[model samples]
Target: MIALIQRVSSATVTIENETVGAIGPGLLVLLGVEKGDDQAKADKLVRKVLAYRVFADADDKMNLNVSQAGGSLLVVSQFTLAADTNTGLRPSFSNGASHQDAEHWYQYFVQAARAQGMTTETGRFAADMQVSLVNDGPVTFWLQV
Candidate 1:
């Protein structure tokens, strides 16, 4: 599983002109599921996402986790993140998990986030989504598990 985690002051996702998910002062998670990724990977990634310190502290240093900073989470499914673009101009989806598997893991990840007592919002899987965000510090990380 792969996650492109971005620190955002605010973020929103829209589908067909309807807002489906939004968040303030939190992490925007663009999730991608690859072949062989399973529940264990999903669970580990969730834990990391919650615990990873990307927010600034009193010292103005990056020292606080999202929960400690009191921020929400906006999780969005992004199969394209699994694209193989290292070689050709075109990307390949061959390494990505099947649609069924990807959706299952995506839901599991979201549920796991909520279970951790965090405010979590999500985009519908497989939908054409328009995502907007004001990236805090423009801080971003690509995490894999």
Candidate 2:
């Protein structure tokens, strides 16, 4: 499992002009499920996303985790994150999981995050989503498990 997390002041996902998911003062999580990824990987990645310290603290240091900063999470399924673009102009999806498998793990990850008492929102799986965000500090991280 892979996650590209961005600290954001606000974020939203729209499907056909309908706002499907939105958040304020949160992390926008672009989640990807690769071949061979499973529930354990999803669980580990979710734990890391919640606990990874990327928020600024009282001393103006990036030492606070999302939960500690009282931030919500907007998780979006993005298989493109697994694209193998290292070799050619066109990216390959050879490393990405099948749609069915990816969706299963994606949902499991969201449920696990919510189960951990985090404020979580999500984009519809397989939907043509338009995601918008005000990236605070433009801070981003790529995490994998």
Candidate 3:
């Protein structure tokens, strides 16, 4: 499993002109599941994302987790994160998990986030989604497990 974590002042996910999920002062998470990824791996990634000290504290040091800073979370499924382009111009998604399997893992990841008591919202799995965000610090990080 991989996650492209972006800190955002606010974020929203829309599909077919309808807003599906939204969050404020939190992280915008783009998740990808590989063929061998499982609940344990997804769980580990979620723990890392939640506990990562990416937020600044009162001293202006980046030493606080989202929970300490009282932020929300927006989790979105993005299969492209697992794409490989070493061969040519086109990216190959062969490393990505199948759609059905990916969806299952995605749901489990979101559930894990929710279990942490954070306000977690998610984009529709496998849906054509347009995501909007006002990036906070324009901060982003990638994680794999």
Candidate 4:
């Protein structure tokens, strides 16, 4: 499993011109699930995401975490994260899980986040979505498990 976490001041996801998920002052996590990922991988991702100290502290240092910042989360499934472009031409998607398998892990990832007390919102599985956000400090980080 992999995730690209972007700290955002605000964010939203729209499908067919309907706003489906939104959040303010939170993190926008673009998630990717690879072959063989299971419930334990989902658990590890949630725990790490929750504990990651990306938010700023009172001293203006990058010391606070999402839990401490009282922030929310907007999760979007992005299989393309696993795209391997090292070859001469087309990127290899073999590293990514099958669509059905990926969706399963994505849902589990969301459930794990909710279990960790995050006010998490998610994009519709396998839906065409338009995501928009104003990144806080333009901060971005990656996680893998």
Model 3: residues with Cα > 4 Å off, grouped in runs: none
Order of quality (TM-score) = 1, 2, 3, 4
Q: Whole-model Cα lDDT per candidate?
A: 0.98, 0.96, 0.94, 0.93
What's the TM-score of each model vs. the native? 0.99, 0.98, 0.98, 0.97
Cα lDDT of model 4 by residue, 67-104, tens digit = 89989999999999888889878888999999999988
Kindly give the stretch of ten consecutive residues in candidate 2 with the minimal lDDT sum: 38-47
| Candidate 2 global TM-score | 0.98
| Tens-place lDDT digits, model 1, residues 35-119 | 9998899999999999999999999999999999999999999999999999989999999999999999999999999999999
Per-prediction tally of clashes: 0, 0, 0, 0
Candidate 3 lowest-lDDT run of ten: 110-119
State the number of backbone clashes in model 4. Answer: 0
Candidate number of the best lDDT:
1
Task: Please tell me which predicted candidate would have the highest TM-score against the true structure.
Answer: 1
TM-score winner between candidates 2 and 4:
2
Pairs in steric clash, model 1: none
Tens-place lDDT per residue, model 2, 1-145, is 8999999999999999999999999899999999999877887898899999999999999999999999999999999999999997999999999999999999999999999999999999999999999999989999988
RMSD of 4: 0.8
Ranked candidates, highest lDDT first: 1, 2, 3, 4
